[model samples]
Target chain A: MQDIYILFQVAGVGIIVAIIHTVLKQMGKEDIAHWATLIGFIIVLVIVIDYLSRLFNQIKSVFILQMIL
Target chain B: MGSILQLFVIIMVAAMLVIIVREQNESISFLLVLLLGIFVFLFVLNQVEQLFNLFQSIVSKFDVSLLHLDTMIKVIGVAYLTEFISQLLKDAQLNSVAVKVEIVGKLFILLLALPIFISVLETLMSFIPQ
Candidate 1:
């Protein structure tokens, strides 16, 4: 529910960044466009990485609980 | 689901038209087709999750360890995302870069699965009374 929403929000940012990069590249700003793409990727990675880390912790806790039980 | 089918048909028709137009020049038409594929794939992204859950449920019916299942799913995700990124790089004419990224992705996925592999092996070994 909320997770899907957050995921979509992050995906939307990625789409926007890609569009901007494409447009900039078309306008002959290859260097700037590439840098922008890199930044966009970093931003998306940061958001997704946080979620992944949380998921890893959840997986760890669940495994621990199962073992203890 | 019906809409996805419809979109696929539309893309097919568009591709046919592009082929016909190839006599003029294919560069822009090819780009359009590529964009069409991306847009359609994005539109049906939700269906993919349904497929993943279906796979998870089927896999869970087995006696396999959850750690192995999780590792497998993560590896599958990594493979899919790496392919997607590599394809995009290829589209941008960065084939070498795509190859490098794919290698890195494979290494990362291997690292992620190493722990699960070791645990499974140890569990199997202990079962043999060694």
Candidate 2:
């Protein structure tokens, strides 16, 4: 339910970032275009990482696995 | 049933989106895929947690020890988490790392199963000994 929204959000971010990168490149700001992509990557990574941690916590709480990572 | 259909639709849409975005930004495309994978896993994970809670209650009804069930749950958890990570690495094109992650997961599962193994061995020994 809520999870699907995050999926769309990521896809939207990716598409938006792609558009920005290309538009920036066409404007001759190749460096800024690169930075945009990098920043987009980091933003996506942060979102994914936040969820990843939540997932780990959920697993820990549910299974209570002693050898959990 | 409905959720499965929903998941299928989501995956299909996400796949097409990946194809659409792949041309412009490979990294973002990959990120989109990664996020989708995690979402799908988490969706199923919620169901699994519910199922496990049910199992816990059912097991409590029996007079048997819970140690085995606890081990089984741990093994299942370990297997799922590691497989999810390895698959993510595979998606990222790190075959070697994926394989290592899988192997380590199997090793951890084996380590967790040692008590069950010992119990089985003891039973066999009881049957064969003088």
Candidate 3:
């Protein structure tokens, strides 16, 4: 459920970043476009890291019972 | 069914977007594909949970020792987690790192199965002349 939302958010970010990069490049601001893309990548990476941490926690909780025995 | 349809739609959209972006930015396209892969796995996670619950119920009715069952579950979990991580690594083009991760996973699984192996060896030894 929440995962679906996160996926959409990531896709949105990717598309928006790509658009910004193209627009900035067309305007002869290649450096700023590059920076925008990098920032977008970092933001997406942060979101993915958050999701991965949640997944790891879930996995730990699920296997904790098995670990005790 | 509905969720699967939704996932299919999302993947289709993401794939088209990746193709469009690939001309301009290769890494971002790759990242989009990676994210889609993760989402697809998560979409099936509910089924995995149900399967685990079924295993629990079935195992509970048997006379098997809880220790053995625990070890079995742990081994399966280890396999699953290792596969997931290894696939992610492969997606990132870290092939060697992915192989290392798989080797480590196999080692951990082997360690987990050691108790069962020892018990089987003991049972076999009991039938020996020595």
Which residue runs does candidate 1 get wrong by more than 4 Å?
A1-69, B1-4, B13-37, B55-66, B127-130
DockQ of 2: 0.66
User: Which of candidates 1 and 2 reaches a greater DockQ?
Assistant: 2
The model with the greatest TM-score is 2
> DockQ, in order, for the candidates?
0.05, 0.66, 0.40
TM-score, B chain, candidate 3? 0.77
Q: Candidate 2: fnat, from 0 to 1?
A: 0.60
Off by over 4 Å in 3: A2-5, A26-28, A64-69, B1-6, B62-67
Give lDDT for model 2: 0.84
Candidate 1: the clashing residue pairs are: none
Preferred candidate (lDDT higher): 1 or 3: 3
Q: What docking grade does candidate 1 earn?
A: incorrect
For every candidate, how close is chain A to the native chain A in TM-score? Answer: 0.82, 0.84, 0.82
* lDDT tens per residue, model 3, A1-69: 555666557667877888999999999999999999999999888877676666666666565434522
Ranking by DockQ: 2, 3, 1
The candidate that wins on DockQ is 2
lDDT for predicted candidate 3 compared with the true structure: 0.76
Residue B125 in candidate 1 has what lDDT?
Answer: 91
lDDT of 1 by residue, B38-76 (tens): 445444445655666776787788745555666666666
> Candidate 2 on A1-69: residue-level lDDT in tens?
666677677777888998898899899999999999999889988988888787778888777674556
Task: For candidate 3, list the clashing residue pairs, or say none.
Answer: none
How much is A41 displaced in model 1, in angstroms?
Answer: 19
